[model samples]
Target: MQSRPSPVPFPAASAFPKALSWVLVACLGAGLGIVALRPGQAIPAEDTPMEAVAVVPATVTALGALEPEGETLGIAVPSSAQGSRVEQLKVAQGDSVEAGQVLAVLDSYEVRRAAAVRAEQDLRVAEAQLAQVEAGAKNGAIIAQQAEIQRLNADQQARIASQEALVNRLVAEENNAAVELGRYSKLYDEGAISALERDSRQLTLEAAQQNRQQAAAELVRLQSTESPQLLAAQATLAQIAEVRPVDVALAQATVDRAQAGLQQALVDLNQTVVRSPRSGVVLDILAQAGERVDAGGNLLELGQLTQMAVRTEVYESDLQRVAVGQPVQVSSAALPQVLQGQVVRLGWKVQPQSIITTDPSATIDARVVEVQVALDEPSSAIAQRFTNLQVTVEIDTQ
Candidate 1:
């Protein structure tokens, strides 16, 4: 039996046995490869297809920021409302507003309103005065100088008459005193009256004479100076109408002054209520109701977001390849889709790159030219959602 086993070992050493061993080795490798690749599993990188046709030609890439086509319009509190506390705020951030729409109210409105009312009252008073003067001029041509003159003459005559009466009384008193003095002197010579009584009568006669002289002088003054003054006043009255041109002008001036004051008060009152200067969306709220702010201080920010553009900075070296009206592709990590646009403007000068990336490995310093790309309609719809957001722009310079 051992001899027969030796004879079978001869087949194991044959060429067919060697071929079978090679086949086994090949089958094992095939099985191992099959095991490595299950259904729905990814193929090895080496097995992936790398062949592709020429698609995108050449492009100039740049970094940029998104913005409205007209750029942001910065809005602040009205200069007239500076240094006032906000009493009422009608809108908040992100609220859309129209031109001249009230955004907030200042606490000084009550004061401004009071001033306006006073100015209006003053204006009315001036207007009424002017109207009264005009009416007088129309109704009465000129003041009656004759009537004024007659009144003055009458007053002068009355004064003159009173002086005459006083002179007559003093003359009669003087005559009486003289008679008494003579009687007293004669009695003294006869030694019938005392020396004291004779001296008293002499003093009484002197006093009566002095009084008559003063009364006569006063009557003369009234007839001369008083009559002339009355005549002069009558002459002046005759020269002017009921209301002179100068008077009218003064009244008109008062009206003008009142008008200016009223206008100023109205302006101040309008300023008390802050209004939006443009139609747009509110971007940020810098102040709230009941907050006090200084003149010209910022209270909020607004912008037009529906229509937007991309402000890009291209390499100076690539300036020649890029031009206005060139088509562009804009992309951003903040968004999911690639947006389209066209270059609307080219920078006239070259400057340092302003689009610095947050990545530490990014190149921050480079000479670049600023470019403005206007977004297309479909792209604008997407751009409106990301104002001031940084983006990558690719201009097809091919």
Candidate 2:
């Protein structure tokens, strides 16, 4: 029976086998071509209509670092202080500090403190002197000066009175001698007195006149000297009784000089103790006890870790999409959870990227703009401990 069927015309079976083989080959070739072309075309969503699919908002992604609200601060010694050594450290790493709180004491502390103390004493002394001058002479001194003036006036009056009395007595004697001389001359003329007696009377009258003249001249000289003495004593009393403007000014100037000295001393003394410029936590100590610090050299690293932020270096091409108040997403390997923030600032300059990746294929020469994102309170609290940690930032630019 098989021999009989084969012998019969079996063209349909042979044709079917050949056609099936060709069709199978074509199907395989078409599938290979479709797979080859698939890489160049976007894959269509399965079981979803293109019109109903939602459009994703555009975003700018960049590498960034976690920082404090203001950023990490390098606390250093005053510029004016050079080659200063740390004597004592009042804080340790991770210590919370307030603004203006003393962080360390320098070796110059004791010397500067002593200088300040001396300056303060000098200021007090100068102030006292100024007060004394402004108040004029003491009450007791004024009283004593007034009493001396009065005493001088009384002495002058007594001397003048004594001189006047002597002059008056000498004038009386001269008058009597003149009368006696007249009488003796008349007697001599009348030949009633001897020549020797008349001569002796004349001599006595001349002597009396000379004595009166001498006494009058002495009284005038005494009055001139005594008047000036009394006037000088009165001037001395007046000078001590009232405050003089020139004297007060001189005393006040001394006080001002002392005050300035004290202020300078205080400033120098304050420089001996390094204080926190802001409220923050100490991230690290750059200079330890017994270590020397140069001008502008760091003493410690500090940050306001209570409020955290992310500093993103957005590509210049994507910077146009970034703006203040835009929502941002920050992620880091060190962080347990994603952090949320909003763009608060955008850089005005475009510079070379600072955040370098370990990946050799990463674009290292790309220019970027700094974008500052302020984290929410909860995010900040969580990210504070990871300051300066590298992170990935995504900014939604819908």
Candidate 3:
């Protein structure tokens, strides 16, 4: 009876629980198998909404390419010959110039005027000196001196002739007295004359002897004095004739001094007119007309821009790769144009760190070397277009 009661209670338990569980399990396994066996398929936009995101492709390059090592240098306009205020400006900015061309001129009015004055003064002084030398003397003084010399000569000759005549007269008187005395002496000797007559004849002979001796002395004196005076007068005339040579030398010296002064004045005048020392284009004009300028003052700036050069700094790591004569490519951030250039030189030393970047991680304390690159083919047109333009230079490491 008990066993029958227990079977009756279990019968009311689950309603086909085992059979229903098996069916559900089979259905789930088949559904999972169909899902796994089907080919992979993308979910449709309509079925599952997807996010609309714009994706950009990433560039594959080295970190060095992203931030290449380069240098930025200041633009320099070449200098011209330092001068004073510009009196004349021949060319303007952006003008093509040749070698030895005159670009500007300083004030030359004063210089030219001074030069003219000096030239005129030189000529006038030279002419005056020449005329003075040619004139010989003022107020006919030389002519009067010649006349006086002639008169002195005539007087000396007349005196000499008078003295000679006196000597001849004295000699004649002495001869007559001598003959009378001789006759008286012979009468006395022959005993035909008295003692008184003999004494008187001896006295006359003694007196004639004395007179002859005096005349001879007078003649000697006249000859000596007259000849010397005549010779002296002739010597004086000869000296006068040679005086013109000395006068000519003095005049020539004066002319030379005048010429030297004129030359110095001309040099000073030329300094006032400042001319260009070389041929180049004017880059800057610091002075103008009517502006006072001192010597060596900066007046203008000139430069040769036909050929350009770039100065860049390379990192210490990449410095070994750079060398002289290596080819380089130059580009400008603003222009974005490429230029061909070659390395002309390399720095021997290194430079200090720069403070351009604030990132501590980006900054390096390592030294940098400078490199100079010259354009292979430079043109005036290109230079003018890109004058003072900032450029970036790149050197191949491989």
Residue 54 shift from truth in candidate 3, angstroms:
32
lDDT of 3: 0.62
Q: What's the residue-level lDDT of 20 in candidate 3?
A: 88
Question: Between candidates 1 and 2, which one is better according to TM-score?
Answer: 2
Give the per-residue lDDT digits (tens) of candidate 1, residues 124-234: 999999987766633243446556777898988999999999999999999999999999999999999999999999999999999999999999999778677786876
Off by over 4 Å in 3: 1-86, 89-91, 94-159, 176-215, 225-270, 294-297, 333-336, 352-368, 378-381
Least accurate stretch of 10 residues (summed lDDT) in model 2?
1-10
Worst 10 residues of 3 by lDDT: 59-68
Predicted candidate 3 versus true structure: per-residue lDDT over 1-398, tens digit per residue: 45544443455447788878999999999889778765775545676777789963221111111111132122111222223445676666655556556555556646666676977688687869777767655546667667767887788778778878877887787788789888888898899999899888778777877877887787778667756666676666665555487788878887887877777776655554544554445555656665645544555555555556666667776776777877777675544456766777888988864423345676566566767777755422344445455565676544
lDDT of 2 at 351: 98
Full-model lDDT for every candidate: 0.86, 0.90, 0.62
Ranking of models by TM-score:
2, 1, 3
User: Over all chains combined, what TM-score does candidate 2 have?
Assistant: 0.76
Please report how far candidate 1 places residue 10 from its true position, in Å: 32
Q: lDDT: which is higher, 1 or 2?
A: 2
Q: For candidate 1, what is the TM-score?
A: 0.60
Top candidate when judged by lDDT against the true structure: 2
Count backbone overlaps in model 1: 1
